[model samples]
Target: MFDELRKALKDWYKVHHRDLPWRHTNHPYAIWLSEIILQQTRVDQGLPYYNRFIERFPSINDLANASEQEVLNLWQGLGYYSRGRNLHATAKCIVDNYQGKFPSTYKELIQLKGIGPYTAAAIASFAYNLPHAVVDGNVYRVLSRYFGIELAINSSEGERLFKTLAQDLLDEAQPALHNQAIMEFGALQCKPVSPNCSLCPVVATCVALREDKIAQLPHKVKKIKTKQRFFVYHLVRNAKNQLAFTKRKPKDIWEGLFEFPLLEFKSEAEQITFLKDKVQVGAAYKHILTHQKITAYFIIDNFPAAADTEVIYLDLADLEYHPIPRLIDKFLNAHRHQIFSVGQ
Candidate 1:
């Protein structure tokens, strides 16, 4: 069953796979860049970012030498800012420790900061043709549905089971092709929602389709608990036409990014009470993270408080030079006329 499934997937991939830039090269750096950029990001969205990064940085050494802010700026629209930071850090580490060459083996690749087991396996197989199975979300879904496995993917037992099954099904002689085929198959054909099962090469043998459990397979034991956060941003413009902005500190969201002076409230009531008297600058912005739902409001401070050392005043024109969260960007864009009118 595994052998036939493998052949069917590889055959399907040969005729139907999308022609992505990363697939054209076996260079570890390019492959690694694509994988990282595509994490939690769609192929269409991440493609431009991958191209921009490759064009701007060109090499691992070039990326290593670039500033963290520069990396973050390029990565502004793409959430999960930590991945940007880690990408920069890992580039530097590679240059300093590995002499700008990517570690060839999975063991060495996994030791890098941002490279997890899935990423390491992807790099190993896709770049070096090493026989390491890639077991990501796509793989888990495909495997669970194909084999009718009932184990929760997030559980340790399920992880081991899936990993072993994936490895067993892998075509050792053509690991790169097999890995790419299975992942692409999962992404394009056997999708999480409304899979193209009718056209799938292994549709005849798919257990999920046979048992009507396509949506129920690949079960997760844990559900993410989302936290509600409320923020009030003070858009204080001084007499010099400069707005007060501060860099976010570490161990928090948007760390190292710049934004207006912020005050966080524990509840919506507290946030509403504080903003009741103040005039809102723009429509309230709601930004959703993996584990947090943040609703933020921006208000103009006519008589601003004494400036703190951490707060830096920047001309409206200079705001582009600083990295800010998308929520702040949305506010600025929405109320550009009002902000500029006040400044003038």
Candidate 2:
């Protein structure tokens, strides 16, 4: 079964695998950066970031030596900032303990900060051609559907089941190519929505296709209810053309990144007038996250030069020095007129 899957997958991958930037290199540092950036990010969206990271760091030592703020700044628009933090921590570990060399074995790799089982497997196989299973979202989806498994992907049982299956299916002869081929097959062909079954090379042997249960085969745990959040952003600018921004602390969304002064309300029924007393109101917008819809109200305020002592000030000319969330970036763009108008 593994041999049949491998042959079909290898044939398909020869012509269909994406020419990703990370795929062009075997350097563990580069592979690690790509994997970190690609977490919770689409391949197309993650590519430029991957290039930027490689250009910025160039090596594990470079990344390890850089400040956390600098690392977060580079990872600004890419959400899930913990990945960046973990990447930085792992780089430091590699440089300090491993003498700037990424660990070759999956055991040593997993011991490094931020290198989880899947990431370790990816690095092990992709970098060292080590025989290890890479059980990512794509692989889970493909395997669950192909095997007609109904386990909820979020469950521990599902994790063990798929990990076993992935290992069983791995081709020891060319672990790197085989692992990449299966992952790529799932990403491009056995997609979550509207899969291109007609062009799928493995369709002939796909159990889901034979049973006519493509969509229903890979059962998922029901989504948890998302709580709504109301955020009032005080986009205060003073006479010096400086804007107010605050760095979010760790454990918060957009951690280590700057945004306008935020006042979070439990519900939308909170009075805007009450909010106005806290910060001068100027503009407002709503932004949604995977688990929350944040109704963000932007407030612009002008203050006397002496009164600007409280807010963190970014010189209008040097706003780029600070790393801000994309939502804040959008708000600044939308209210540029209001900010510029005040100083004029």
Candidate 3:
């Protein structure tokens, strides 16, 4: 049974696999970079970033030696900036501890910072051809619908069951090809929406097809409630024509990325009251994340001197070099008139 299923899937893959840049490489560093970038990111969007990153930092040592701001700048538009941070940190770890070589086995790969189970499995199989099943969203969808799994995927038991089933179906002789085939089959063929069930090779064996449970088979325990956040950014410029910026602390969405000095308020009234000095407020900007929705308002200010705080100020001409969030980039582009209207 396993051989039949594997043959069907691998045969489909051999003819239908997308010519992605990551798929052509057996280099562990390149594969690891691609996996990290693709998390919470689409392949179309992540592919260019992958190309740019590898081109700039071809080797792990190059990534480790580069500044965090350089990495974040390259990853500015990509929402999940933490991946960039971790990519750099892990590269440094490899260079410092592992002599710039990615861990060769599943156990060692999983032990590295920011390398989760899915990533570990992918690298292990693709780079080393180790017999570990990749259990990403694509795999979950494919296995759940084909196997008629009714357990909530968010639950531990469900995860265990699906992972076990995925492992059971893995073709150990061709783990790399098998892993790629399963993930691609799910992404292109058995998609979340209306899939091309007419061309499905395993439709006869797929329980969800016979029972019309494709949408319901991969059950989730709960729907996530995105947290709301309000941000007040003070875009300060001094007589020297330098704009101030600060680093986001850990545990935040844009952790280790640069942004203007920010203050959080529970409400608009509270934010207005907290403003010791009246400043020109720009239109509100909204930047949505997977688990958080950010409403950011910019306050434009000017002075003859600096605030004497820890804020690092850069010339307006040099703003392009510093890494800022997409929200800030949008705000700056929309209100460039205010910035250029004044001079030192």
Worst lDDT run of 10 residues, candidate 3, spans 301-310
Ranking by TM-score: 3, 1, 2
Over the stretch 1-344, how does candidate 3's per-residue lDDT look in tens digits?
Answer: 67778999999999999999999999999999999999999999999999999999999999999999999999989897888899889999999999887889999999988899999999999999999999988889988888788998889999899899999999999999999999999899989898778899987898899999987867898879988888888778766866788877788788777788887888767876766565655667788999888888777653323355357888756777777788888887788678646432
For model 2, residues 198-286, the per-residue Cα lDDT tens digits are 98777778888899888785788887788778887766766676777777878868988887776677777783654645444355577
lDDT of 2 at 287: 78
Clashing pairs in 1: none
**Winner by lDDT:** 1
CA deviation > 4 Å runs, candidate 2: 223-344
Better of 2 and 3 by lDDT: 3
Could you tell me the lDDT of residue 330 within candidate 3? 84
- Score each candidate by Cα lDDT: 0.91, 0.82, 0.86
| TM-score of each prediction | 0.65, 0.64, 0.65
Q: What is the lDDT of residue 238 in candidate 1?
A: 76
Instruction: Give per-residue lDDT, candidate 3, residue 185.
Output: 95
Cα RMSD for candidate 3? 17.1
